[model samples]
Target: MQKIKSIFKTTGTKNGTYSVGLTVIVIAIVVVANLIFGQIPEKYKNIDVSSTKIYDITDTSKELLKNLDQKVTFTVLAEKAGADDRIKTFLSKYSSLSKNIKVEWIDPVLHPSALSEYDTSANTIVVACDDTGKSTTVSFSDIIVMDTSSYYYTGNATESEFDGEGQLTSAVNYVVSDSNKNIYRTTGHGEATLSSSVSELMTKNNYKVNELNLVMDTSIPEECDLLLMYAPSKDLTEDEKTAVEDYLAKGGKVMILLGETSSADLPNIASVMKEYGMETEDGYIADPSRCYQGNYYYIFPELSVSGDMAKGITSQMVLLTNAHGMNLVDPARDTITTSPFMTTSENAYAVTEEAQKQGAYTLGAVAEETISGDSAGKTDADTSENDGESDDAEQEEQKTGRLTVISAGSLIDSQITDTFTQLENTTLFMNAVSSNFDGVQNISIEAKSLGTEYNTVQHAGLFSLLVIFGIPLLILISGFTVWYRRRKA
Candidate 1:
């Protein structure tokens, strides 16, 4: 008993007791830290430090999710073991963003009937809306984009971009919307057909695209919400132009893509543009400062933030290959409001066979005009009557027709394609179309390139020697120095 008392007294010294307490406190801190971190939301926990932010969702997605009226279930058809880490992290962000979004993982091996009702394969994601009983399936291949352009024909092909966010957000929007918008592409004027990438993007965004020939139909179809004319080699006939004018008079939206023309006369189309105070020039634009590979013809246009055409486009530069120049005839037209959404550099020049004109030119522009006289009549009544009802009526009767003109159609042409470089051009085109046809949201997430890397050490032998022997030797020296100091003290 005496020996035991003595032992307790020795162990209960102030320094010993403090050390014991500190150790216990450290263990408690670790336990609490683990608990706290584990409880945090996955979206906040997983920091996306990737160069392209492949896992992070865009602000467009957040805005769409904030207004979600229905519950969306994301069912991943794969075993957790086989699922990719990046994809899993990306999907978790959706559930954390909105309470209406729910994510569930199902192993195909355990329960085959889990996804039996839906036509889904392994590694597929089904975004379903419970309210509408509609669902959209996103294949795994769609998420991982590859460069299929002819530019890669002679070189090694690589994965160009990650479109997981765009695909999943579009799926959510599609399943939740009550109806899809109809887009009509003009035909029979030697117009270029829509590229496969653009077509896939339209389909993913829940747009019903159909071909419309103004010559055969004699009028724009009633189901056409937006009309698209891309790279027409020939000019439109008088009757076709009249049909388009009539369509625009009824609050229609049109997108025209014109390539650089060398003596190609599109008089009827020019007439339509003149009505809206937009004039297309005859030569291609060349810029030294803002071009690809020192090729002056492949110009990069500046994005105009003030215009609705580039409202949601976050890309810094938009490429326009061999583009013509356009000018607003009247910047301050009353009935027609024009905004040059894309412009060339001040030093850029318009190149033609005869001569070169140097100046900043408009490459893309958007025009909005009130075509109906009902608003004008209401305004007249408001001036005469001077009443609050007339003022309110005039405000409610205002409606504007929209038109977007892009100088270069090759920027979006996938057939003459290089997707690795022209991703922003595609996004800009999509944004313009979506903005004009109501508030349909289409998020454009650029793909990340998987390029080859070479890592080399300048002094490989020195590095190996230090790592193999120097660190351990230094540690031993540090311990000995401490012990020696204590002994001397």
Candidate 2:
């Protein structure tokens, strides 16, 4: 009992019982703090500090989640034991974003009946709309996109990029949307086909794309949300042009990509722009200051911040190769409102006789016109044929239509051969398209390459020494100083 009392007695000038109690209290505080933190959601607990934000949810996803009215259930058909950590964390972010989004994990081996209605495999994700009884399935292969170009040449594929956010968001959009937006691409005039990347972007944004030949159909389909004419090699016929103008006059949207007219004449097609007092220049544009790699023909135009086309475009420079210049004949046309959103540098000039002219040239322009009067009753063909008969009241009650014209057709050409340059061009084109349509947000996410990087140390020996010896020595000194002070105390 005496020995026990001595063990528990205060030492020096300190109370041993108080010191023990304080230590116990400090440990208890740490334990309680960790317990509380552990109870928090993984999405809130883990910090995403990756350079590319590989696991972070995008603002586009957050916006969509915020506007969601119906309950969306994301069912993950995978085993919990071998689930992907990144995917699990990414889905958790959606759950925390809104009360309308619910996430669930089901082991396919145990609950096979839950996936009976869905065509899903072991690692698939099914996003279902409870109100509409609609669902979209995303396979595991869709999340990890591979560069398939290698398979065509060498029969091997390397993992290219992560598309989890795009695919998952698309699935969610698909389930919730009442109907997909329909885009009609004009064909039969040698119009260039959309590239694979652009097609993929449309799919990811929940757009249904179809081909329309005006010659065969004689009218734009009623379901067409937007009509795209990309690099038509031949001029549109009078009837086809009239059909297009009629469609536009009825509040339709059209995107026209004009090619260089030096080689080919598209008079009827060019006449479509005449209604808004905008026409394509005769020669190709060359920018000495902003051209790519000192090539004047590959001009990089400046984006206009004041225009709607460049509203959400983050990139300031757009690469346009073999582009023609545009001239606004009447900037103050009473019937139309024109905004030139893209222009070349002041030093930019034409490659032909117009090169000697002095001024910045327009490369992209948007025109909105109110159709009324005799013009309202007349198609483009009728207006071009008969120009002189209209009353004042007929012009008063008019409906508005929009036309977006870009001088460069190569902006959407996949044959450009430069991946980075192509991406920038595609971004600009998609931004313009998105701005023209209502309620259509740009959800195109570029896939990030997982290439390895090598860092070269300037002083390898110094770095090695610091890492091997300096850190440990500093820690040892700190420990010794603490111990020496404690002994003195």
Candidate 3:
């Protein structure tokens, strides 16, 4: 009986100990599992609800909002179905960040009245404001990609998934900023228009471009900040001359893009340049090695970068201008300092008329100066010019730069879009222009935007959120339930 009693007690103690040990083991396993897998919902049996990263405050939209000061409205003129998810997502992200940006959806089909007033198209955005009274339209193609390589819609029948959020953000930047500067480009006598790809790029970078026949209007508009003379085939009227002089006297900025006009022919303009610093030569600049498409056009020549205008943009760019030239001067005026913005390599030569007619010649150059006559940095009137008739070819001491001067009448050819990358040029040029100003703030000009660009992934076919979070969740639930049932039993 004693032995039996002892045996029974031993067995009871062992059973109790075994049960406690098993329960402890189960609890440990549950705790370890929770630590490894994280939380999961029940319905998503195969889903993994775990996330490796947390939501942060600083995103691309937020960074963009922080840079903007003016109130901007992004009016979406399409159905939600047509809207690019990336654009909407970016706008939504921007909306949550700052009160300065507001998004409104307008179905152009439903309201035909808006189409006329806003000139809006399908899947488009009209960025506008009541104060500036200026509005810019962005089409679906304007902000999105046409193809994966070399962006152009394949005969207007193809579209690519474009995360245009990044670029459109930059566009909104151009319109809303105070630097939407206007460079009134002279036309008539046949100058180029903003319709060209290069001009389009100029406009995109805070320049409100307009073809001006100052001869027609007599007065250069008060709103215009600068004037540009680009390959004008005709001479300016006396009134036009006075208009130009008056603008310069008022401390306005001017850029002359000259062509194959003779020295005597450009007397009025040459006289103005001579007052500042230099004069355009009678013959064309020629280089055999640098000639393009043949001898009439210059080819890859080493360009001179000696001024702010040239140095600012040439950080990483190779220019390819054709038949364009200029008469640049570095005047003694305290308000001006002209320098060679571009030049061909030393292996280059400025061929006179004899060589030009011989079917070989150098054809382009660039020139610019810091014209600070007043507090706002303006160009002074051509007050003192000798108009020297010095035809000395001994310009070995003459300093020129990458401010390209193309002798060819058409440096910016119609096929400019095919030959050059306008997007790249525009970005750097805009940066240069923004930096050129005396007192203004440009965010990109100052520094990089922010932390890592938070590009949101597409919400698509069941793999993204489901696989990442759903599957882990199911195992967690099943494990917990089995533990619970075993405990109950």
Candidate 4:
């Protein structure tokens, strides 16, 4: 009896030792695993579970971050307790995307000297770059855009959008990029000014829009990347016309937005367009088959997908109000190439003072002229060179001048563009002006909604069946397999 009791004690002691060893091994594994995973960035580990993806960055932002080489920092000015949760969450996710991006939160009250150089409020965020030593501020109001237009009547303000992503992305782009295209809007011709939305869009895309009166300035500026003539009521003077002609000859770009005026009245503008093989028609275009509602004058023109201005546009529909039509002067000009950016159907008709005429017409078009540099300065003696020398000379560099014509000045109007939100009127105009520009990375990202989002499921019956029966069946099968193995063991 004594020997048997001793053996039982030894067995209990060995079992206790084994259990402690197993527990130690398990704890060590968990600790090591946690340490390893903590080194990994949160972007790779944490998944955004929000339905509206408010915490997630867009694919455009991702692509920009992927190719980013320069170091960019975002300094948020707020105390830890007073910081906005939306801004903190977004910046955390944003910084995890790229190693070059660093985000720092500093309390304004504690460190007032940190923001001494910046002219911004306590809640504003500043995006800066070390390499360029450039910095730009994004205000709290800029991040949370509000629609107070209707507040006067309603006595309440509506949240337009949470524009944190758009504002931060644009701010970062501005600080790092060195290129800024100057867009000169021609003045002194009683032209309509650009709407606030249009002007803001140009600024966001890194295009510096400035006013230039050809009548007063004598010539277009040397830094002018694009010349804009937005619905000039009065015609340009002869000197102004000559200045425009000279600008175009030197590989310049021009965008003309036509308003309701007779070709007879604006003969100078008509002549300038005719030089590019594009003639402006007199009257408003009406398309009964392709119009908004029953209003034939509010036309929905079809896009010319092949045109450079319409290259990446997914939708073919755009609104043009009170627009005239354009006619190609010469379809097969030797030196000039023409592409219609937008056109009307065969059933379209034009309403003039005299009568209405039925015909298919171009609503907008782009004309490009390639001027050969080799033949410009050569005399008769230079033309007498041997065939080999002439061939080599012909291969010299050439310059191209481009003109884009849109027959509707109302395309840029706030009422029309803002009302027809589904249409691509604003997008079409931006594409036209920015076709020849390079390194244009500005894209409009939809603002995240601050409202509640409900889960929407399609084919409810199928989803219910999968959840109810399929899942149970899978679990039963897995349990039975596990039980059979245990029993066998």
Global lDDT of each model?
A: 0.78, 0.77, 0.53, 0.80
Query: Model 1, range 1-489, lDDT digits (tens) per residue?
Result: 999767767746757878999999999999999999999988889888765667777787888888887999999898987787777778887778899998988888898887676767888888899899999888777787666773568575456767787788888888888878899998887888787777777876788889998878877877888999988878888888888877776678899998555425888888788788788777888999899889998877887754445546665677778888877796334778888878999988888899899888887888888754353334665555544446566666656677888888986877434455534777777887787765565654444444443678997999999999999999999999999999999
Candidate 2, residues 1-489, lDDT tens digits: the string is 998777766574258677888999999999999999989976688788765566777777777878989999988899967887766776776577888888888998898886675765788888899888889888766776677887998899876667777787888888887777888998888888888878988888788889998878868888888899988888888999889888887767898987655534888877888676677777788889898899889887988845435444665766779888878877345867887888998998877763555458888888887765346655699877544545554466555678888888988777662456424677678777777666676766555444444678997999999989999999999999999999999
Write down the lDDT that model 2 would get.
Answer: 0.77
The candidate scoring highest on lDDT is 4
Choose the strongest candidate by TM-score: 2
Off by over 4 Å in 2: 9-26, 39-43, 148-156, 260-264, 305-308, 331-333, 353-356, 372-399, 415-418, 421-423, 454-489
In candidate 4, what are the lDDT values of residues 348-466, reduced to their tens digit? Answer: 99889898989989988888888655443456677466345654565564667888888889888989877665567777788787786655644444356655657889889999999
Which of candidates 2 and 3 reaches a greater TM-score?
A: 2
Arranged by lDDT, best first = 4, 1, 2, 3
Cα lDDT of model 3 by residue, 39-114, tens digit: 5422122322213111122243356677667878888888876776645654554455567777799887787677
lDDT of 1 at 100: 92
Query: Which stretches of model 3 miss by more than 4 angstroms?
Result: 1-66, 69-82, 85-122, 126-137, 144-156, 159-167, 178-180, 214-218, 237-239, 262-264, 288-296, 300-315, 321-335, 353-411, 422-489
Candidate 2 versus the native: TM-score? 0.80
Point out the worst 10-residue segment of candidate 1 by lDDT: 444-453
Scanning candidate 4 in windows of ten residues, the lowest lDDT window is 438-447
